[model samples]
Target: MKKVIVISAHPDDEVLGAGGTILKHSAQGDQVFWLITTNITEPDGFTVEMVSERQEEIKEVEKILGIQKTYLLNYPTMKLDSRIVNEMVPRISEIFKEVEPEIIYCLNRSDAHSDHRYTFDAVMSCTKSFRYSYLKQVLLYECISETEFAPALPEKVFLPNYYVDISNFIEKKLEAMNIYASELGEHPFPRSERNIKALATYRGAIAGVEYAEAFQLIKFIDKE
Candidate 1:
């Protein structure tokens, strides 16, 4: 089975971007790993108890997703920009070496959040051709609010050309998303259950499936 890694700027991003894909990989017995770069704590208005609760929720999400392992850096939230590329690249590269993932997933560079954008840049740097030799493919998935809410510029838009049919696992994706109690919202909001299904439905329509997740295939190196 293929080894896969989903890297995100925050905890819930993996769910919003690639939850169903993760489930599909796990169900097929492909090893799946999660790499979360930031953490929420007092600075984000989360008390100690809330932080602990959030951690527990992440574990539940991981368990439900059938993630073989998770690497949580717990970097300061929303401040990834302050960190230099050198600082982020090495740590991420280390994980790349350990996992030797054939498939790598991360946020698109055009995402609205600075953290997401910077994380994308760092990941691109870390997985350079000269660095991760085993890496054969890389894809970028869309985060709900952060991806959809980007500025109205052609360059900033998320244009996905790849799609994964998740008709069978949409419910599992929603169940995994719901684990993050603080992140969910009411209908009409980006992270709401209704909106999540709506987005999946919209993407499925593009791919002529009942439900699907869209992605940008950044690179697919076939050396033979």
Candidate 2:
């Protein structure tokens, strides 16, 4: 079985961005693991105790998505430190020593979010020692919030080089998203589900699939 680890910046990113591929990988006998960098903790709105509850929420969603295992790093959302990247290196180095994934998928470095970009940088930098050993490919995925947006500057539009046909698994994408019931946004749009569906459709249209996911390829070793 091919060992795979998906490092995501926030909750629901894994499902939204790579749900179909994850399902496809696992169904083909790959063991997929998740390394989450954020915890769903709202001390004011949901109370501080919700972290543990959200932990359970993460697990349930992973199960529903048929993921093999998930590890939450509990990094703060939108706020990432440069030092944290160094800190994560050795730890992820250890994980690579153990799981030794054949593929690692992360957010693109040029993404809008700092945390997402930082995660991509750190994940790539840390694994240099294993350059041609364990990790063969590191692909970048687009999340609903992060991926669907046009660049703040006019010239910097997000372009996808490859697309996956997610027509069959879009329902599973929606199903997995339902687990994060506490993730309602402030009332301009209110619920995030509607937004998620719309983004999926949008990316789907861009990718030419009825419902699809998009990715940017970082390393194409054997490609000539």
TM-score of each: 0.95, 0.83
Per-residue lDDT for 124-196 in model 2, tens only? 8755634437676777887766654526554444557877777787777777877876665543553476766
Question: What is the C-alpha lDDT profile of model 1 across 1-224, one tens digit per residue?
Answer: 99999999988899999999999999999999999888888977879998898899889988999999999878888888745555888888898899999999999888889899888988898777777888898999999999878886886677899999999999999999988868899977789999999999999999999999999998999973
Candidate 1: where is the Cα deviation over 4 Å? 43-45
Q: What's model 1's overall lDDT?
A: 0.90
Superposed Cα deviation of residue 203, candidate 1 (Å) = 0.7
Local distance difference test, each candidate: 0.90, 0.73
What is every candidate's alpha-carbon RMSD to the true fold? Answer: 1.4, 3.3
lDDT of 2 at 56: 78
Per candidate, the number of residue pairs that clash is: 0, 0
lDDT of 2: 0.73
* Per-residue error (Å), model 2, residue 20: 2.0
Find the 10 residues in a row with the least total lDDT in model 2.
Answer: 182-191
